[model samples]
Target: MPEYQIFKNIQKHISLSDSERQLFISLVVEKDIAKKEIVLEQGSISRKLYFVEFGSLRAFNVNEEGRESTIMFAVQDWWITDMNSFINQKPALLSIETLEVSRLIEFDFSTLEELYKRLPKFERFFRIIFQNAYIREQLRVLDKISFTTEQQYTRFVEKYPQIVQKVTQKQIASYLGVTPEFLSAVKKK
Candidate 1:
């Protein structure tokens, strides 16, 4: 097995011995996802968490009017899942779809539970991951309420320059809570 990216990501949070690494790797399944594929649909149960090895994905929710609100995006070396659904084994509130042909490492819910029991360090690693995600989301909320649209766009670009390159302007506009036309005008100014 080509074993570097996922191990590298885990090493940042917790140290794992060769045996532990092997065990964890054994439990994961690698997937090649097609562009625009819906990996998890809203209202369906989410059974797996994905780590992007290469390419990008977006998670979004649709309202009664069928308008999408982008919740988040995941790219190389990042993790993506409908956390509420994954944790509770309930129906997902967000749908996850690929933005490009992507390679991902997936961990099934039961496998993760077993891994946690066998390798306790993973619990800490996942906790840290979720904590950082929470912090980022909280800051994003504050930025939305406190900053102007232009300022928000600037900050988004500054923070996720890589994402800006990979995704469309319309997707970015959705993330920033603006219309694509507004985003274009902001870019023009």
Candidate 2:
């Protein structure tokens, strides 16, 4: 596809031999999904990890009150999945939904295991990615505990301008752990 270059951009981070790359490409399944579609619903087994080729998606959970709380957003070049569920073959605690019409390359459990077995480097590649993800999650948790609402918004805006520009204010508020009304108030200031 015309977007091969963008996918290659991610491959550049971890060197893969020509044969391994060919095999990896063969194992991926490409999908095009509509905006607002739920690719992984809470309570369903999550067996795949998706790499975004275009557009965006959100991972979120519903509270007892039925309010949605966003955990993360994945855009082009990013990966999205319920990690625990995908790794353990358990029902997901989070739901993954597209925020825009999106193209994705997905790897299921069997293919991922085979990739690791066939190419040991593949294991290192994902290990690094997961380590970075874990560190980022740690920082976000610290921010949620220590930063003021306005400060959280500032950090978010500074770090993810693309998301701020494209996502709805309501969803942003939810992700920032604030109410829509409060977000509006913050914006006015």
What lDDT does each candidate get? 0.92, 0.88
How large an RMSD does model 1 have? 1.0
**TM-score of candidate 2 to 2 decimals:** 0.94
**Tens digits of lDDT, candidate 2, 1-189:** 234543574576677666766777888888999999999999999989998888999999998889999999999888899999999999899999999999989999999899899887878888877888999999999999998888899899999998887799999999998899998899888
Best by lDDT: 1
Clashes of 1: 0
Q: lDDT tens digits, residues 44-75, model 1?
A: 99999999999999999988898888999999
Q: Judge candidate 2 at residue 78 and give its lDDT.
A: 82
Candidate 1 wrong stretches, greater than 4 Å: none
What TM-score fits each model?
0.97, 0.94
Error of 1 at 140 (Å): 0.6
